[model samples]
Target: MIHSALEFLTQELNSFIKLKVGDPITNRVVLSSVTNEQGIAIPDQSLGLSLINIEEERTSKDQQNRFINAVGKVEKRNPDIQLNLYVLITANFQNRLPNNSSDDYVEGLKQLSYAVAFFQSKSVFTQENSPSLAGFDGDLKKIFVELYSYSFEQLYNFWSVVGAKYLPSVLYKVRTIRVQENAIQQSGDPIEKIYLESRHKP
Candidate 1:
C-alpha cells in the first residue's frame, strides 16, 4: 500500500509538470533519495521523492477483529493498521551550463513550486479516479495529501541528520495507508434472530 501510494503521487505529479513545462523527453519527478547509500548526491536534474518517516494513525485504529464473511459466517482477523507517511520531494537539478547562462538552482526552485501547486490542486486521490493505483482492488480506498511544514529547529535537525545540504524541498503528510492480512483466526455461525418472551408471575 505504501509503495502504491508513493508511486501514484510521483507519476501524477510528474505528468502535471510535463503538461505545464511542455517537456516530454525528461521526467520532472522521480522516486529517489536526496543522497545515495554512499552519501553521494544523485546527479539527476529531477525532483526526488523520498519517504522520510512513517507513523501510525492511532485515531483511526480499530480493535474489532470479528466480522461476517461473504459466506455469512463470523470470522475473526486482526484489524487493519492505518499509517501516515511523510514524503519529502527535493529538487536535484545541477548547474549544467558552461557559461552560466541559466541557473539550475533557480530552475530547481521553479520545479519545486510546480510540485506545491500540483498537490494544492489535487490533494485527494482515490482508486476510482486514479485506477492505476497498484493492487487497490478493495481494502485501500483513499489517499489524502497535505502539506507538512516544519519549524526552524526541526528543519535544522532533519538536514543535519540526513547529512546533506538543503535543497529546494517540500514535505507532505500522506494519510491512511491500511494494512491487513487475509488469514482468519476463527469462524462461527452468526445468530439468526433473537426472540423475546413474556413471563407471568403466579
Candidate 2:
C-alpha cells in the first residue's frame, strides 16, 4: 500500500469540505464539500485528470505513432510505471452576459475536461447537458468533474469510449503523468478513500 493513501488524503480531508491529497505523486486526491477555484465541487482526483492538448501539431500520423510507440517501449521496460497525458489552457475569454462578457478564470480547467471527453469520441452539441459514466462504481463526482472539464481534441465533434466511459468533444487544459500501478491509480483508488459516493452511499 502507498504510504500516502492512508496518510495524506485520509488525514487532510476528514472534514466536510477539503482538498485532500492521498498520493500527490500519483495525482490521487479527494474533494469533499469542497469547491474548486471555480466554486465547483472538485470531487476526487481521477475526475481532476490533467488534460493533454490534441491540437494540430503536424506530428504526422506516423510521427504520432512513433511517440506512442516510444511511450509503450518505456512502459515495457518498467511495467510498474503507467504513463498518461494532461492538457491545460491559459487563455481568458468572455461570454456575453447581461452586463458584459464575464471571464471565468476556471475556464481553463473546464475547457480541458471537454477536450479529454471529446478525444474519447463524445460530443456535447446534441444537448446543453453532460453525459454520465453509466454507474461504474467509482467516484461519480470526480468523473462528473472530468465530464465538465477538457478542450476540443479534434474537428467535426463526435463521441466515443475512453477508459470506461462515453465522452463528448471539447477543449481543455492538459498534462501528462507516470506512476506505479501499485500506487494510487486515481483519486479514490484502492487502499485510499477518494470515493465520495462511497462515503454517502446507502
Candidate 1: regions farther than 4 A off: 100-103, 134-138, 193-202
lDDT of 2 by residue, 128-197 (tens): 2322221221222121112235335532232231222222123332111223332322232123335555
Model 2: weakest 10-residue lDDT segment is 137-146
The collision pairs in model 1 are none
lDDT, residue 33, candidate 1? 70
* The candidate that achieves the highest lDDT relative to the unseen native structure: 1
The ten-residue window of minimal lDDT in model 1 covers 94-103
TM-score of each: 0.88, 0.19
Off by over 4 Å in 2: 1-50, 53-78, 82-84, 90-92, 104-176, 183-202
RMSD of each: 2.8, 22.4
